[model samples]
Target: MKATKRQYAYYTGMFMILVVALYGIFLLTGKSFIWEGDGLAQHYPILEKFYTWLHQGSLTGWSWDLGLGADKLTTFSYYVLGDPFSYLIAFFPKGRLELGYNLLILLRLYASGLAFLFFARQRSFKPASQLVGTLAYTFAGYSLYVSIRHPFFLLPMILFPLLAYGIDHVLSGKSWIPLAIFTGLALISN
Candidate 1:
């Protein structure tokens, strides 16, 4: 028997609900309160330094003495560009940055799921095939591994399918500059 449209929507909704519940459980059981590795906190100094820079107009980097000769400030320099996300994080109350980061994780997971669904639709998969494809991506091994490691890396993975779809739309000559800028912003946003 073929699944009706309502049945498919029900299945998709249930799957999304389950994904969110699983993500919450996963967040609760992680090694650290925020699930980001030790290297994540290494940016704290830079965060403080950025707040100082905002008020003082200093041009120096986070710290010349912080890390090893070459590797010390490399990670912090990732934010040296005008990305305001970190600044936003720093603006919140001192103890609430973890909450902010946790919200970012949830958003990343949702975006990853949507990206998988877009990919499945692009492939014209049958309902079951699409379900499998979405599940494969949204719950893949890398998801588990990344949860314990550099969790933010998921942002790029989440944007991959959507960016591909937009680029394809542009290359088909239906549109150009919008997709180009969209993809470029996705790259820069990370």
Candidate 2:
């Protein structure tokens, strides 16, 4: 069931439109599943502390005392959870919170699209089948389950398909540029 190039292109385009629509609605409604008992609030301060570390490079270890007060990282593990995008957002003119969220959403979409393209290029499945498979991988029960319970994991999930596709292409004797670019993206996406 080999998928023609044109069919793959069409399905990929439609998926992009769907992703954009969903993301736009989420942004406009300012709706998030975040809740008070969610523990997200507890993490905010740790993120702020990491942001400080990204800039200062002096705030290492579990806890450190500043001149004014003592800071504790008792529950915070900076290495695993630190987001580099925090530093990138500081360059934005607008507020960091909104900008950072928007950036994350955009990156998610781009990664999904790249993954779809890679799926289409596989050439083993029909174009329609490839589209359905990619979308299933992107929005299926597992994805939905993760999105609800451990949403932050979505970033790496979005990235996984693209990285797999890029690797597949490189293995199939395609150009190195796509693989190289995706490798760089995977590295910087941390």
Candidate 3:
């Protein structure tokens, strides 16, 4: 189904409302989204290191920070290096990483909704059904569970719908490139 501008606007607005409804309390109270466990002790620090590296324009070599020193790129590659969204951290100033971290989680969730919408639209789902499915997929229990505690996991969730759409394209006698590209992205995102 061809989506009109009005439908796009409606979907976008609805997505924002859903996000705000779910997370607005914390925002209003100025509470940190960091999960106090792995999020505070591990993820945020790793992300701060990544930000420092990016800000310094040097993402190579060893760092003593990782327990008596480790290869910077190699260590980070297991965490943020492969996720494309992690690169956005460079835009956040040094002191405001916590805010950036929280905002990025929201952005990732929104992107997940958009990915699901793209898949539903490609499959010709009705507009209302598309909206419902997008919202459900975006706000699913697993998605919410991982958003704060394991934000990188959202990368796979976001890519899964696109990968499914690419599979549809290939099965319908289209070029295999889309499937291949999506597969590569899904793999690299992890």
Which scores higher on lDDT, 1 or 3? 3
Which of candidates 1 and 3 reaches a greater TM-score?
3
Cα lDDT of model 3 by residue, 39-106, tens digit: 98988898898898888887999888789899988888878999888899899888889989998899
Which ranges of candidate 3 are over 4 A from the true structure?
A: 1-4
Find the candidate with the highest lDDT and give its number. 3
Give the higher-lDDT candidate: 1 or 2: 1
Q: Give model 1 RMSD, 1 decimal.
A: 5.7
Q: Give one clash count per candidate, in the order shown.
A: 1, 2, 0
Best candidate, TM-score: 3
Q: State TM-scores per candidate.
A: 0.61, 0.54, 0.95
Superposition error at 141 for model 3 (Å): 0.6
Candidates arranged by TM-score, highest first = 3, 1, 2
Estimate the overall C-alpha local distance difference test score of candidate 1.
Answer: 0.59
Q: Considering only N, C-alpha and C atoms within 3 Å, which residue pairs clash in candidate 3?
A: none
- Once fitted onto the true fold, the runs of candidate 1 whose alpha carbons sit more than 4 angstroms away are 1-16, 19-75, 79-92, 127-132, 171-173
